[model samples]
Target: MNKIHIIGLGLLGGSFGLAARRKFPELTITGFDISEKNLKDAEVLGIITEAKENPDSDTDIILLATPADSLGDILEKTLNEIGENTLVIDLGSTKSNLCARAGNHSKRKQYLAGHPIAGTEYSGPKAAFAELLDGKVMILCEMDKTDLHLKEKAYQLFEALNMKLRFMDPEEHDRHLAFVSHLSHVSSFMLGKTVLQKMEDDRNIFDMAGSGFASTVRLAKSSPSMWAPILTENKENILQALDGYISNLSSIRDLIAKSDGEKIHQELADINKIRDILDLGRG
Candidate 1:
C-alpha cells in the first residue's frame, strides 16, 4: 500500500504502523486517535509518518483498532467514506458484531474483518513495538464477502509482517475466542481481585507472591476500557466457559476436602498433558 491510515493509535494500531513502515519504508502512514496525546505520541515515536484529524480519502488502506464495542459504528462510518478501491481492515477482538454491522453496507467488499491474536497486557502508543506481530496468528472472518483484490492486498500486508493466516466464520471465531481468549482474561481479573481482597487482611501478601501468581494475574493489568466490551460482546460463550470452569473448580475443591488424593492426582496429571497439546514439551 502506498498510503495507509490508522484509527486508534493504541498498542495494536501503533504496532501495525511500526511493522508496516519497517517492511515498506516508502509507505506513508497517517494516524488518528480521539486522544490527542496518542496521536501526538505516535507521530513523535515514528510509529506513523503523520497525525491526522481523520483518515485521508485517497489512502490505499484504513485500519480500525478501536475498542471492541465501538468497532461496529466506526466500521460502518469508515466504509461509507472510503475510496472505491481502498481496503478497510479492523483489528478488533470480537468479530460477529462488527461483521454483522458491515453485512448490508454498500462497501462491504472493501471491508475485511480480522483479529491479530497477539499482544502484551499493555496499551497505548508507548507500549507498541515493531516485532509485536511477528510470528503471530492473523485470523480473518467472512473472507468470501470481501473483494478478491482487496483480500489479496490484505494478504500481502499481513504476509509482510510475518503473520500466519487462518480463515474462520465470524460466529465460530467469536465462540472459540470466548473460551480461549476472553475467558482467560476474566479468570485473571477475578484472580487478581481475590488476592487483593485477601491482602486487605494480610498487608504483605504480595511480598510472598511467587512468579506463578505474577504470571497468572498479568492479564488483570490489561485495559479495562478495551476488555469490558469484549467480555460482554461474547457473553454467551463466556458464560458457558465460566460454568464449566466453576464446575471443575468445585470438583477439585471437593476432592481436596475429602482428601481423595488418588483422584486429585489423576485429574491434575491429565490436565498437565496440555503441555503436549501446546507443544511445550519436556520443559
Candidate 2:
C-alpha cells in the first residue's frame, strides 16, 4: 500500500483523506496537524489511517495543507526530507507566491500547485466530509512546470475525488479568484460587521435575520487564520476587486439618497443577469 502523508490535517486535508479512503482503499493516509486535537480527531474519525506529527521519509506522497504563509517553508522542508520519487502537492488558496517560492527548489519536479475551488464557511477537522470535493472544480496552476509523471499522480488524485480539472497561469488564477471568491468573502464579512455594529445586541441579529441575510453573511464565519494569508498573498488582485465592489456600493448609495426609483430598478435588473452566469456554472 502507498503511504500518503498529509501535512496540516484541517478541513481540506481531512476531506481529502475521507475522499481518498472511499476511492482508493489501498492507499494509507497519515495525517499531521499543528493542532494535536485536529490530528487526533482526524484519526479517530477514520479520515486517516493514523495521526502523525511529522512525515516519514518513506512516505510516497505529501499533501501540504498548511495556511499559505507557512506552505512555502513546509514544502521546502518536506522536499528535503522525502525521497526523489515522492510526489508533493499544495492545496493553497492563492498560488502565485507559493508556487514561485517552491518553483526554484531543486526538487520542483516533485511538487505541484493546486487550488480546490470548494469549501464552506466552516473549517477544521470536524467540518470535513467525504463529499466536499465531489463535482468541484480544482485549478492546477502552471501545469507545464510540473514533471509529467508527477502531474499524472495529481490527476489520479483529482480524478478519485470526481473533481473537474482546469489549468491556468498561477497569476491568472489568483486574479480571477480575487474577483469571484475572495471579494465575495470580504463583502460578506463587511456586511456582517456592519449589521453587528448597528444591532449592538447579538440577539437582535438572530431574531431579525432573514434567509438572504444569513446566506450573505455566512462567509463572515470563515476562519481568519486561513483567510488572512490568502488576502495578503493575493493583495494586488484583491485590491482591484475591492475597488470595483466599493464603487458599485457607492452608486447604490447615491441612488438611495436621491430616491431614484427608476434608476434603482434598472440597476437591480442589470444585476439580475448574474443568475444566468450562475446557472452556467452549476455544471
Identify the candidate with maximal lDDT. 1
| Candidate 2 lDDT over residue span 1-283, tens digit each | 3778898878898898889888989888888898888888988888889877676667767888888889988989887777876789999999988888888888888888899999999889899999999999999987777789767777888897899999899999999999999999999999998987887765554554666888889999999999999899899999999999999999999999999999999999999999999999775
Q: On residues 1-283, what C-alpha lDDT tens digit does candidate 1 reach at each position?
A: 7999999999999999999999999999998999989988999999999888677878888999999888888888888877787999999998887888899898999999999999899999999999999989999999999999878889999999999899999989999998888989999999999989998888864354675998899999999989999988888888999999999999999999999999999999999988786874234
TM-score, predicted candidate 2 vs. hidden true structure: 0.95
lDDT (C-alpha) at residue 218 in model 2: 91
**The 10-residue segment with the lowest total lDDT in model 1:** 274-283
Compute the lDDT of residue 18 as modeled in candidate 1. Answer: 97
Global lDDT of model 1 = 0.91
CA-lDDT, candidates in order = 0.91, 0.87
> In candidate 1, which residue pairs clash?
none
